[model samples]
Target: MSFTQQLHQAAQNIWQKSLVHPFITELQSGQLPLTKFRFYLLQDRYYLVEFSKFHHLLAEQAGNPQIKKFLLQSEADLRACEWSVRSDFFTGLKITPMEIRQTAVAPTAYNYVNHMYLTLERDGFAPAIAAIVPCYWLYQEIGQKLAKVGSPVALYQTWIDTYDSDWYEVNVTHILQLINILASQATATDRQMMQTAFIRSSYYELQFWQMAYAKERW
Candidate 1:
């Protein structure tokens, strides 16, 4: 199987959980509490800060110019979104910049982002990229699924559209290509390690929704 296919097969159960997860179902149906979504947004901002950092480091360490270029662009996209959280996005919701700044990372958020950092620090760029791919790929898949039913609520529909856009699918393809390229040269052991990283991160992605559902803190 292609490396991307192998990784997908390995994480099939996790993807199924993510697809049918109550938190996501509720969000799509406009049944999710705003407070829960607000909590998710808050933690997600913190998560993106770390994601941006991951790409910055990847850009620096990558030998291939294409990889470096992709990472740089990825970081820029994340930072642009981060910039919007305070003003364009959440301003009307009373979620001030200070409130976002003051919100502590929940345990799930901390573990997920920290795991990304740790993967890069411990295993170098390729595995780290593998580890983080599910966030984009799974979300892209979920977004497309969501687009079919399409939320009735304006705000929730906006979220769905954001993920369903062409840009995100491009990113999914780009990242998968990068991973496949890296996997091509990897030793059997290294490829297996990469698969492990992908599986573990996929698990964390599942937990994140549950965390939001429970409105976890501390």
Candidate 2:
């Protein structure tokens, strides 16, 4: 199998579990308590900000114009997404910036974001990209799947729409193309590292949802 295919296979179990996770199932049914989602949205900011940082760091290291452009775009998109989460979404709910600032990061969210930082800082592009791809691909997978289920809640519906937008395919295609290019040039050892990074990140994806489900704190 191609490396991307292999990566998908490696993460397949995690993806399946994530799809049926209590948090996701509740989200799809629009039965998730608002308090849980509130805490989740508040805590997610911690992850998104760090995610933007990793993209900016990658953009700095990118030599290829396309890679650089994509990384910069990714960073910009993440920042905008964060703003939407904090401003448009939260403001609609009357959550002030001060409130968000006061919200503590959940332990799993902290670990996941920190994992991205360490993986990108310590690894080459192949493994670094592998480490981050799950966040993009997994959310897209969950979002699109949830989009197919009609939710009574507007917030739940809009959240699904945002993540399931058509642009996700374009971004996924571009990133997969980049991954194929990187994989072609990678040594077996590098490939193994990439696989390891993918698995670890995928595991964290599962934990993140579980955290949201449990409304974990500290």
Instruction: List all candidate RMSDs to the true structure.
Output: 1.5, 1.5
For residue 16, model 2's alpha carbon misses the true position, in angstroms, by 0.7
Q: Candidate 1's residue-wise lDDT over 16-112, tens digit each?
A: 9999998899989999888888888888878877888888888999999988999999888756643453344576567887887788889999999
TM-scores for all predictions:
0.95, 0.94
Off by over 4 Å in 1: 81-87
CA deviation > 4 Å runs, candidate 2: none
Give the winner by lDDT: 1
- For candidate 2, the clash count comes to 0
Residues 1-218, candidate 2: write the lDDT tens digits.
78889999988998899899988888889889888888778777778878788888888888789889998997887676645655667877777879878788889999988877787767777788888888888888888888887578888888887778876667777777888788899899998888899999999999988898888866
Q: What is the lDDT of residue 21 in candidate 2?
A: 91
- How far residue 157's Cα lies from its native spot in candidate 1, in Å, is 0.6
Candidate 1, residue 139: CA error in Å? 0.6
